[model samples]
Target: MSERVVNPTGRGFLLLDSHPAGCFATVARMRAEAGGDAAGPGKGPVALVVGSSAGYGLAATIVGLARHGIRGVGIGFERPAGRRTATAGWYRTIATASMVAEAGGDFTFVNGDAFAEATKAEVLDLIAERFGGVDHLVYSVAAPRRTDPATGVTHQSVIKPLGAAHRTRSMEFDADGTAALREVIAEPASEAEAEATVRVMGGDDWALWIGALAERGLVNDGFRTVALSYIGSALTAAIYRDGSIGAAKAHLEATAAGLTDRLAPWSGQAFTSVNGVAVTQASTAIPGLALYVGLLRAVLGDRMQSPVEQSVQLWEQLTGARPLDLDEQGRIRLDRWELDPAVQAAVTERWEAVTSATIGEHADVEWFRTQFRSLYGFDVPDVDYTEPVETDLPWPT
Candidate 1:
């Protein structure tokens, strides 16, 4: 699509493409969300974001800068620059960074790994040099490959159920909007894989960043730390749980405890939010998750489905507002709203109605496709997707 309609609600973000045109369109979208005005946060915040290119990461960054006028420093690696599907979220980030700078908030990007001790040190050094110290830290890194500094070996994670067979219906992006029938994939994971997955997605990396901040004295008073987490419906339990990633998240929840407790004396608090899912490159690859999330979006009301709105809602409700709604276990429940009793009941009812023998006749296929295409900045109504995208993605650059 030529012009992407950014979500005005401001809860999170809905990404267009990584194209230069796409970037311009996204800034337009964000501005529109901000009521055709540039965003600022009083004096603004010194913000640091990992995975700040697309999905929730980008949304959080944009909200931090565009809505609050905070200057941000982004740290993460790019996906070798070309190839759209199995790629990097950097294009969106680059465009957004440029947009933020033009809007008057500084946005410096660093291409680096978050899992490495060296990388954390480097980010700390930069923060000390540039913004003094970050008032807010957003850690949203999602990596599949992590290297063991001690062993010099690389580990790759898989998205299969742990032990039993998991049945799930998925959106076949290739098929446009139709739900593709397939048996849920199940594979065994080793202890090493499980541990590695925890190391990569869990809270160790987050803790490392915090520790680094503390060491550099860059963590300001009452600094806040947020990391994203998820707990889909029971249907996703197997692939998510026994799966390589879920185990990591379990550790992540616990990691928040450790970090929060550790940061307590300094008046810093750690909170994790379960965010609403809009289509993203990373979410698209998940087996049944695409269709599930797509249908979930179609069924959810207007405001909740809008990523930008969602991010704003998140900031308003969870971040910097009142104390976040942490469970007795000290975990926040952002996504729980999406999975609330009424919401889940509706989604379940809707899923059944749309998954029958002749489901197409009853379902809204148009909406389904729109959601999928919107993930890549295609099929957006306001944008003219034709005439070749002129936007730069830093591929050849």
Candidate 2:
């Protein structure tokens, strides 16, 4: 394969291309850190992770293979247009499949819209033919829109607040690595808009997946399910915790209870994991979150947890290797350290005093940039970006 210099396209939270070598390196690093805790070959649980292309989904998949030797089925929506580069998630998947093969674990990737009924059916068929049943299902889908299969209605989620227009401090990063801080105002969502957000982002699809799996008798006894979520502190609460997306998250967490009852027949359980903050594609798109994460990393220092680290802990709880840390609402609180009182206090102090001119003094801008770029395989360590690399790598079957 001829080498090509793959620079990241788009700017300020928008990425259009990915580096294959860098994406592979990123997965390899995460797998190594997760450690080979697998008891033996074929000893791990059989898992299906929706949205397993990037962010928490990708991390969970890698951790499952490296830490638990899970035979995994990953569902994601990514594109690899001919001549142009594929999405970062596609490269990540290829790398992950290689890891699974090396570790002697089974893996299958479904590349399509997870919201569609056809996609659900395909996953069910795969489980029945290959794995017999699923032991754990991780719902980590993060999409801006979803079209209901039955109604043929498309719902687009918004990031606006609920009651009133919310204003917050936000930052924008250019492709050249320069960033600027500015104030952003997000308006209140209309009734229809709020409903649409819930439809796209809430637990509806998650519930649907479980319902289908249960109906197909694809759930093993002691089956477990978890949907990823985030509950930020007061720093970006107005734009995040109280925003339209937050409403959907609340619905997601509430669905866990009903789902537990559905899985009760198999003695199965369902939970919502409130994950810690890290630079992800979704997080970078939210207003003020980029800055908040930057400040959080600066204040927390080594206390900060990467998505992979959180996934490692999450599996420990799911597999009974560690105690589940639940909140009053019975949801796993992986974001506890991020929401710690001391950490919040420190972050708040920096948030208030940080200005456009002084952002570098209070925030870990370099770290934030690195994390964000690494999501698209641009700034990953040990990857020689100066060398030309193939962009037309085939997806692992």
Candidate 3:
């Protein structure tokens, strides 16, 4: 078959084929950061990672397999390959599973809505039949909407500020010509909207997953679970730190605390991990985050780390000999690097001076665009995009 083509447009780039090289690059990074294979392990520990198909979850899964030689069961919601479009997460999952199998690790990919009780039941059955139990449960789920199992109420997350509308510079790539910066205003979210955001993005589902697992006797003793969260600088506070999503994060953090207590009998621990901001599918959808990420990247420069790198750091801290370090809020601080005073100062300086006219010169627009495209399996230097690709690739069985 010929290599898949990439059609770039203003909205985003669509991949025509599965870029194996790009996927392999992700694996290579995982290996490098892990510092070679871990010693003395029988297929390592087993892990169940929700949202393991992409973003932080994908990187974490890769690290588990490549670095620690863990057997992995991944649950993700992804669009199947259609006549006209192929989902990047589907391909990434396939590529990741293939690599793990080749490296002599067991991997299973389940594509479905993680919030559904049926999906949770499926996970429990799989673990019973295969790995018996999981040592780690990583929750990195990001969704625009979530349906409550009890109330049957579906809540949609909004990216608006909480109190007042905030205006900021936004960047967009023009498929026709040059990149453009425009003034984007994010309106305040209503009380109901804020509640809905928390309902969708909050940790209710996460808590439910743990409860179900524990009740089913699937959680092993000393098992640990982690949910990813974020706390950026003050610059984006209105729409981020103190915004609707922030309310959700607060709920998530609180959930972690409550779950920790619930799991105390089994010596299990639950933690909310504060991660650094990166170019992710979820981040791009946030109203004014793209501009901030671009500026943050420019300001951080070499200090900025990718999800793969951050995953390794997290793994080391969790699995290493030393006890995990947490902030006063009882959360892992993976975002400490990003929240450094020097970095924030620089970002603030740039944020204040940035305008439509100066955005091009001040922001790392190209880097942001490249990272965004990379998530979709495009713009990898080693990948041959000119060749025709097989769109109907099989999922890892």
Tens digits of per-residue lDDT, candidate 3, 1-397, equal 3335545433533334335455555555555665657443455887889999888998888777777777758998987666544577887887787777667677789999999988989988998888877788899988989989999988998998988989876677666535677678888999999999998889999999899988888888888999999998788788887999999999999999899899998898999889999888888877677888899889877789888878887776666644687999999888888889988898889888887777877788888877887777667666776765666666788
What overall lDDT goes with each candidate model?
0.64, 0.89, 0.80
By lDDT, the best candidate is 2
**Clashing residue pairs for model 2:** 3-388, 4-388, 4-389
| Candidate of highest TM-score | 2
Give residue 233's error in model 1 in angstroms: 0.9
RMSD of 3: 2.2
lDDT string, candidate 2, 205-317, tens digits: 99999999999999999999999999898888887878899999999999999999989999999999999988899988899999998999899887799898899999999
- Report the error of model 2 at residue 294, Å: 0.6
Q: Tell me the lDDT of model 1 at 214.
A: 87
lDDT by residue for model 1 (1-397), tens: 2333222111112332333444456645754674424355236767788877667777777766666676758875766433232133555656676676567667677777877778777777888887788777887877788776657767776676665556677645222224454445555666776777776778876887788788778887777788887777764567774577888878887887788788876788887877666666566666766556655665664635455665666565434655566667776666665777887777677677665454444334466666554554555456654546533245321
Estimate candidate 3's alpha-carbon lDDT, on a 0 to 1 scale: 0.80
- Which residue ranges in model 1 land beyond 4 Å of their true spot? 1-18, 34-42, 80-88, 173-179, 317-319, 361-364, 390-397
